[model samples]
Target: MSSKFLFAALGLGFMLASCGNQKSEYDRFYEQDYKDSVSEAVANAPEPAPGTRTPSAPAQQQPAQEVHPGSKLIAGSDCTACHSNQQKLVGPAYVEVAAKYEENDKNREYLIGKILEGGAGVWGQVPMPPHPNLNKDDAGKMVDYILSLNN
Candidate 1:
């Protein structure tokens, strides 16, 4: 009986030890496989045509996106999490907003107020959360950025 118990205990200990080492061995195998696949893909990739930019080309060779002061302010805030310039997410796209309203002082002021105070129903049922932290001038900048998308 004692021998049987000892054998069972040793078997369990060995099983647990093997299980622990198995994960690390599996991880090493997976990492090697991933590296091999990436290397193969790079090797198989076609070379860039003459006059075209290569993958290793400097960023300065690429055309830069124009940035506005209002865009800079919006990028620093939580606006991007919900809104995009072209595609709609939680709210309408900036372009959509711009399209709906004409560029003018009254509309600009109204949008600034909406940004600061928050509102719903104009676009849909989802209410735009208020931005109490942002001042009127900053909100106006954001509004300007959105409206500029029309042009």
Candidate 2:
């Protein structure tokens, strides 16, 4: 048994030793050439002037107001089964959710996904159910509605 184990160990070691120390395809960033290229790109990148928005930044936060399209969609959907604008039911209140998240398109995109796909832990142990039937446009409208309540 010991002889067989030793043979297996030696064979494994030989296989590993024969393999070169080349980086895997997924580890491209770890390569020295890739690192140098990334550094060069960053150094050459243009800077934004004062008060200008960066390309990667989200759109400006809109003033808190009623998003009517989103409101109507929410009224039609099953969201009212657990959520409301002012207070908690089976899930966190819309106001609480509004307060907890930032008011921006990125946050809106995230909440849209959360609304359609469902998520847990942002509020508590209660899990949200997935709305597979919901369209992204309507989901986004729901997000818009939620963000409008951020007062």
Candidate 3:
């Protein structure tokens, strides 16, 4: 009887542990997207004219970082596992991609397709894994962010 009780307790404990307070993947992605959107808004906000500042406002406001929506998507997804903005890892650096391809409609479409279909021979032998689950709109956003790095 005691052995049976112990086993039951262990199973209960395992179930409780599995259900512990942890953010779901969607929750994490949503939070990151919200944060990035706010940052982008702040970054794009026009500064007040020199004489228009209220006395109560701080003398100097640091420039807000311009975060792209795609950056959040990339962060939330598995892209960062192999790629980075500044340096190459398992894949080419995002900056390199930007440098290679000028931002244009044709390039954008091509890149979006590449993201969905995956490819190799362009960035060396290691093939880029396809993201069948990611939609074209999201892929285009990611490409925009990567291409923006050129500037």
Candidate 4:
């Protein structure tokens, strides 16, 4: 082949090779089966009988209370980046955290500390980065807001 034709072919080959490695959005979404598994587990797990109370429903259905003002600061500052009330993002959903820490004051403090100083292995292998910008009071307020998600 002529020199110009050979270079053009090589460049086209390189472009095609790069494009082959790129995942489609659907592929990317499907690759994380863990998310689907977690969601399924939450959905399929047996629920309390009609008369019995369940933790998940009560927390969401309860009337709103005076939410901590500082909680919004924390949420806006960083928490909402990965967490939401209904779905998993980077971290477990807020309801999951609320269920775990509900009725336990000490767990609240521990989690607040975790927020200030990031740690891994608690929720999963994923390490939650420390938020040095968050002071104790603000962190506490965020924790309280998280707990309130149950209500």
- What local lDDT does model 2 show for residue 44? 59
Q: Candidate 2 vs. truth: CA RMSD?
A: 19.8
Best by TM-score: 1
lDDT for predicted candidate 1 compared with the true structure: 0.76
User: Positional deviation of 27 in candidate 3, in angstroms?
Assistant: 47
User: Per-residue lDDT for 55-141 in model 4, tens only?
Assistant: 464465334464367455654686766766666778888789888786477887898899999999978998889999889888887
Residue-wise C-alpha lDDT for candidate 3, range 1-151, written one tens digit per residue: 2344444455445445545568788756655655555556555656655334355533232233655788778867988778877768889999999999999999999999999999999989999999999999999899998998898
Model 4 lDDT at residue 93 = 84
lDDT of 1 by residue, 1-151 (tens): 2344444455445444555464676766655555555556555656554334344543432244666779889878988778877778788999999999999999998999999999999989999999999999999999998998898
Number of clashes found in candidate 3: 0
Models 1 onward score TM values of 0.60, 0.54, 0.57, 0.53
Prediction 4 global C-alpha lDDT = 0.68
**Candidates by TM-score, descending order:** 1, 3, 2, 4
Off by over 4 Å in 2: 1-67
The predictions' CA RMSDs to the true structure, in order, are 15.8, 19.8, 20.2, 17.2
Estimate every model's Cα lDDT from 0 to 1. Answer: 0.76, 0.72, 0.76, 0.68
